[model samples]
Target: MSLDVDIGHASGRGPRDLNEDFAGAVRAQPGDRRQGLIAAVADGVSGGGLGLEAAQTTVMGLLSDYFATPPGWEPTVALDRLIRAQNAWLADHNRRRRGEGAALTTLTALALQGQTWTLAHVGDTRAWLLRQGEQGPELSLLTQDHALDHPDQRSRLTRAVGLDDGLRVDFAQGEAQVGDTLVLTSDGVHGVLRPTRLAELAAWGTADLAARALVQAALEAGGQDNASALVLRVQGLDPRQLHDEQAWGRTLPVPSPLRVGEALDGLTVTARVADTGVHLLYQVRAADGALGALKTLHPSRASDPQERDMLAHEAWLGRRLTEAEVPGVVRVWPRPAHASAFYLLFDWHQGRTLEQLMAGPGGPPRVADALTAALAWTRTLARLHRLGMVHRDLKPGNLHLGDDGQWRLLDLGVALSGQENAEQRALHAGTPSYMNPEQWEEGGQADAGSDLFALGVTLYQWLTGRLPFGELEPYPRGRHRREPVPASRLRPDVPIWLDRVLAKALAPQARQRFETAEELLLALERGASRPLQPARALPLLQRDPRAALQLALGLSLALNAVLLLWLALWR
Candidate 1:
């Protein structure tokens, strides 16, 4: 059900006057599966009088800061950021006290999350993996020492924390399985004990007993240095999270198109919904007669790896949002154990999209209702932006109004959560009509500003049933020199204050627009009592480059013609 592990650590002074080795392990809070487990070992360089301080700080800093990073960040990204920051701080401290010995240490850290293990290492500190194989228990070294190859200089570290301004950390990742054992040690333990002897001790018993035995054996083997050992045995692995989506999509088979009355994985298809060329949607009924929405790739694009990855990412985002209890989003169901095909199952809500409501026989909702909905939606966007997520596609069609009177944001296939590969970010996503002007330019990428722009466009359409920029195609278009006709102009009932807010939201230049969702929300909350000041006008050139260019050409042409006429008269 969740990541399960047994961990223990031990350190002894051995023949040293003071123990300079530090080791620590921190497990994620119960039910916090995403944070996973972090364990580290640091061996303080003996020459440095502050060796104990360096070892303790490096190990403790990593244990605390790694969890503080954004949950959406990849393990490698988070570790690199924290390690680099710690290294910089320690290096600066050493520079300030130049005469004093530098606080230098060797660090080797490991993170076990879901079904994978990630390692970050430097100096001669080591990590090892012991696994039960068909042949027997095997021990494999997981990290290389950042030291010299020559026998004489083997103990001299080439890379270490606080050694210099620059730090080079080696990183490695591999699949983790139940019954696997991980071990971390300071050079004092591994330098004196042979691999075979270490492996025998590591396989002895409980993690705590095994770790103590390792330190004892190293000291008895005539090791004169401080000895430390940290051990962890995997008891179980958590369900694969977002990082594993690409691998899952690659291995799983894409199901053939299903028809009404057909059942796959206990869900019977009741009706085909929409086929958007890249994907297919279906209305299905569970065994208990509950309705659900199923989404899968269209048969034509079944072989496209990018499409599969995109779908998996969408599913992962949906699940993560739901688990976080993020409001205004649909909940995604876990994949069934007997799944014959790769598809996403979401809780079905009976609702009409904002687009449908705008086009219905009754026409768009009242101005007050639309404004209220916009306020609620903006709050949702604020939460998403705070989490470093951007809903690439935010339009009326993706905004749902449930029969239960709640609003939901849908279709996260193109959203960016920072884990997206460059290829995914470059894809031209979202409706052309709702997309901002910058997104139409070359090399443009979507961000929170883009989502806010789309929201403004959606609200504009909801109120007036018209696009502010007329019908914008995917290619180059006429420059928009003038501002959007105020919403009040299209609908007399729309208030001036609401129009002002929308104008700020729809500013063509990102600098002139509301940089955050919270700012837009505050404006809406103020309403007529505190109307926002009008935005400053842009220079003529920036207002409309096309128009400026045209005017220059026309003036030049007329001046040439006048000169020619004068010359002819003079002749």
Candidate 2:
């Protein structure tokens, strides 16, 4: 497997855009004289004073150490170590030059190991997983934000590279099926682009073309932050039956006692099998055989108190969505009274995930369809907003693709709905890329406007296949500087009306845009004032798979040739 990557940046109205990004695979060994790929991204923080330093710190560390392999090649661990080193380096440099505090910034990185992916990250950077079978996005938000001073200050980040210490990170392992696309980015892309648009960009064409589509969408949306994206399709996976050393996921043998089409309690366990090492995900059939999903916590995690809460929380929230009259959600159990293990039962989404359906070429859906989907998603969010709930972890994984082509939100394990504004003060929750500018800068609150901004970004991705700002730009390590170009510049095909809608949603001044999903819906219904501009179909932005394969082979052989040449000379 190969890693796909992209980066985009803009000098908005502020001092400058500080977003940074990296993609592709990187691995190094002392003995193996081979080259794969080295990718990195750095976003300088605005307002903090030294944005550029932060960006350089991250990229330089990756470039210097990317190929050097130690005992641990786990992508997440590798990335964390690199970021930590970068911060330490930055601190020393800052003290020598200007003295006092160090610069601030964020970094994101990913490497491909054969068919598997290794990842590392710091700050509000993000990694998305789009898979087959599952609908919407099979995203695993890979990084935890270190912002927010208090529970009411949901926007404030408490951790980041170049900060004092304690860099918050979220990490995990996952499967990448053929045609599955992984989109990585800094806060820029999601801040400006929408998920639907992201899926369209990744799937509407080749990975490369789709990547550009996303960037263009961000530009049109008035990129206030640096934006970039790396869209790569999974062409292969470790077909070798997964091993503990390879991937750490829940595993189980097919259970024979509870065969498919068997009734167990009010819900029937159908097609029972192991999904990962920690849990068993079963296709559930109602008394009438109407399908649903019952995921019993893996026997292993059954012992972890944290995992237990997550399982129970997910079930409770799934049921609540049902109570709220949401579609794409089903909860047969009011609570998990009989759950032998931490478990959750949800309606089994039959259609492909947004990430899955989004694969393939354009001739893709019309912008109107994208807009419709965006509106529907926002409406659902509004329901939560009314309930004073927040999806602290609103990445693609929790989303499902329904048979109706609608984007169904799922996984309420971390959903914030404890009390009125309780989510606002909660410290450091939410996917980084989806967060608003203010949230990261100040220990601010998560308001409807911030959620609206996230919704806007998701829509932007579906329509344009890009984020508002490219991850290539450095994330801010200093203070807020200038704003970015208009999203129209990136993808002229986007309706001006839609652009306006995005612009309003992505406004840096959250108070300026639509305050609620309903308000945004009204605006979307109006559509762009200008007609769609004609443009040539975009080419895939991610490098061609065959091309990448050839490159990998060529590099490996060249390294071998060099070693042979040196040995002969020595002899």
Candidate 3:
């Protein structure tokens, strides 16, 4: 199927002297495979004298600037950059005016491509969706008003394009299917017509007819401000993008091994970094002399489909996490169409891994630095977990301390998403020392709890320079019979509260451990004032039934003797 859509927009002055509502859309031709369709609406602040100018420039700028962005950038990333620039420009103009009317507007924009639709919104211009369902045509509100919730103060906007130096645009993405109709409206139209009325009118005819009808209806309903409507009726959907790593891997050819100074697809290998058994990593330079890390299957594994698929999965996940705006993770670049081989390009990070940092000339990191890094790293994990992913391996070597003073998580080669198959979940994939007890059991699967347990071990090592469970080896499992030595016991300066937090995180039983990264992060963030207690041991009955039964009989006989003595004394 081909990407196709019918788009229309209408604007009217209504009862206002001048129209301050502007809307526009751009549909890329068939040759523009990735650009898809971009649509936006902006409604200028009513009190501002340059309202019309503000609305017009904002819409025009978005329509033109959006397509100029690099094709590799995700729709959300591109929109964020463009809108922030627009906000800065508008804010500067307002600042220079020196008491003249401010140039501020509400913006709502959409980008649809390859069966996915992304929305970027600020202020009160609303987005609505109409979809045909088994029952009937269903309408849904796709945006929340950035205004006060109070009825009397509803007109006051809490956020707008040029309201301040800082801009916070709301972003959302979802599947866009054929027969879906997206509707955009300014306050003038929505405030006058209820959602029910709007949806009913939007469902009547072609995009053009529906758009004009909505604007006219708003005007007829005594709308006091300019009314505007933009509609996009999906005529067809493009083939779904291949998100499966295995499928993507089979479509590309792996490149032959390269020596330093060799170039492939505009990237020159500057140095061989590491041979990771299954994959090879090299420090490469682009045409512009910017450094990047290139990862591909090793020469021996070039023909191995499983190895290729794993590398592809890593690249896909890295890009996905980076696009999500999660900090402290390495970013993977999109594969260029001209590329002749399958390889992942990552933004080169200049820093040592945590393992190196620990063993460096400076020695172990300072307590304060460790605490700061832990908090930031926990946040990164929380973001990953929220996206339904688990980092199967987490250790000092996989955690990097960049020169930019950021703690980045590395290597998604064995990371598991919620959608992973049973076979994928059963794969034993992590440093033995860092793997939680649950992961060692039969049919054990790594999950959020396991990741947190690994984080706890990493922190414990960072603080005390020793593994909590000692250096565990792969194979037949050996259970830890005693609680791990606390961080405070090994490192005198390690806080008692932190020790307790780590203890809870490292609990052998999954149910006894912190269930989520956010929970552990909160405990760390609160620190001393709200210290967490160490995980309590399981009850004797649960731990050992025979021991509990013997203890119960001993207590019963002692209680009987005491009762006989007391009765004799009373008599």
Candidate 4:
């Protein structure tokens, strides 16, 4: 579908001597719909050596260089690469000058292609989405502020372009609906103006007027630094082309059940594998005698739009992930002209689920085996995170341990993209016992960090055969302070370093946890060189009840002997 955008931007130096804020929008080439539109806003750090130049370069360079990117690259990937390159140049320039302070700036960019809007953000700059709701207007904050959340440290930024050699830019993608309005602003404007006030101003008149009014409101509210705002209005989209632009989850349909020994669409069902009430899995043989697993929704849920969408998107993601580390889908079986069902074909792996393997007569894997599995899963997750995907449901039940000594990640049904919308975020995608604290919150968003938390929980279970946090009756949200008993305390075989790694991964706060899978893997590889003190004293009774009982008996006998000797001496 074609995108029609109306854009406006305004920037003011406010009380500062020089305006360190820069904002701009680039329109797509005439009739070249693929190029789409680019709009960005950047704010230079106040004390930087080249604050003004940094701001200008970030905005102008992004708008110009984004279009120069390779034509076939996805907007999210293209923008991220461009931003990193620009950041490197800025950092290099500062290093050459060997200045007292480096050039630094906050950037938030939006690229609208077809009916999708992709965002790339760093620093404290913000992006917001405003749309008409049934009752009134609805506003969704699209970007999380990179500044400290604590009140006393709110003014300081934790991340920014050119502040370091490597940049970690946040990227998200969502569908853009007609009549939707997107607003991007620097901290100076957003910090002073409330979201409700900004929403009111944005809905008042034309985009330019709205943008200018937002900036003015910030100024009136005691704007203490450079303030800037960029507004974009989606005017229209082609109706016929809308289907092609639908969200990944919304594009697939559910199919009817398959019968064993039945040949349909060139694949013959050999046997049933699993039949959860909601979904069905079957072992199938292709015409050429190749084995595959076919997965689809249960017939009962065929009419359920949400279930069907999730199943369809699972297949979509399975196909999109081409990395060797990730289990690849063999092919999506085409809907037969006579049949009215959709199904996905995945390479048949002869293996048992991690849960099954752990539950075998052999019990949980040894410490070394557990560590190897953890490392393998971490690397797999790193690849997934790099692809902007989060395996929301990461548990032993969803992992396959092949007889060939390899791990395969299973079940993308509940996984989500980093840029998923609010509705998708609300879906129940994770196991309660393994879920991170944030995943339990209302409207909690899952990201790479959440996945890492799940990994920690899984690894802990593998090592100690129990969950870190005791299973809760009713899933808990908000703050939970209960710390898991250290792994070493439960299983003496577990190394202190491994226990420490699990503790960090399962930290109650998302920020306190390992930031990336790679980071966690590195820690695991470097085992604790020295012994780690236990988090709490495990009473001798708990450590070895037999030894404790033996010692208790000996002490009682000795006390009785001493009492007899004293009695005899007194007589």
What RMSD does each model have against the real structure? 8.8, 29.0, 19.9, 18.6
User: Is 1 or 3 the stronger prediction by TM-score?
Assistant: 1
Task: Please tell me which model should have the higher lDDT, number 3 or number 4.
Answer: 3
Candidate 4's residue-wise lDDT over 1-571, tens digit each? 4567788888887898888888899977775534578999988885643777888898899888877776545577678898999999988887887656777888999988756788899988999999998989888899988898998998788988888889999987776789999999988888998889988988878889999999999998998988899999899753312112233333335556778889767789999989999989999998789898888778898677667556655765665674333532223443233333466667787888889987898886789888888888888889888887888988888888776777878888888864333455578777887778776666676789988988888888888888888675446733245558889998999877787788778765566678988888788787776433334434667544666899999999999999999999999
lDDT per residue (tens digit) for residues 1-571 in model 3? 7778999889999877778888999877556535588999999985645877788898899888887776645577789999999999999998998888788899999988766788899999999989998888899888999999999998789999888999999987766878999999999999999988998999878899999999999999998988999999999986544233344465567778889999999999999999877888999999898899999888788788657756766776787787787898988776665567778899998989989988888866688888899998899999999998999899999999889978899998899875443445567999998888777767777888888999999988988889898998885354443469888888889888988888888875677788889899999889999998656788877644666888999999999999999999999
lDDT of 1: 0.87
Task: Report, for every candidate in turn, its global Cα lDDT versus the true structure.
Answer: 0.87, 0.57, 0.84, 0.77
lDDT by residue for model 2 (1-571), tens:
3333332222222224333343333334445422334455555664544766677657777767866745324455566677777777766666676645557766666655434455566666677766654465554455555556476874355556666644555555544456677777666677677766666665656666766777667767886666666666665443222111133222122122456767656677768745667567788777776777777666566556445544544554555566668654444454233323234566676765455545546534576677677766777777877766677555444555677666777655556555212322355656666667666765665666667777766666556666564342223331211233455666677766676667777665556568777787777666655432332222222223445677889999999999999999999
Full-model lDDT, candidate 2 = 0.57
- Candidate 3: where are CA atoms >4 Å away? 1-245, 476-478, 540-571
Task: Give the runs in model 4 whose Cα sits over 4 Å from its true position.
Answer: 1-253, 323-340, 419-421, 477-479, 529-571
Candidate 1 wrongly placed segments (more than 4 Å): 1-112, 116-204, 207-232, 236-240, 337-340
lDDT of 3: 0.84
TM values, all candidates: 0.65, 0.42, 0.56, 0.51
lDDT for model 4: 0.77
- Give one digit per residue, the lDDT tens place, for model 1 in 485-555: 99998899998898889899887688889989999999999999999988887876898887899899999
Candidate 2 matches the true fold with a TM-score of 0.42
Error of 4 at 461 (Å): 1.2
Worst 10 residues of 2 by lDDT: 240-249
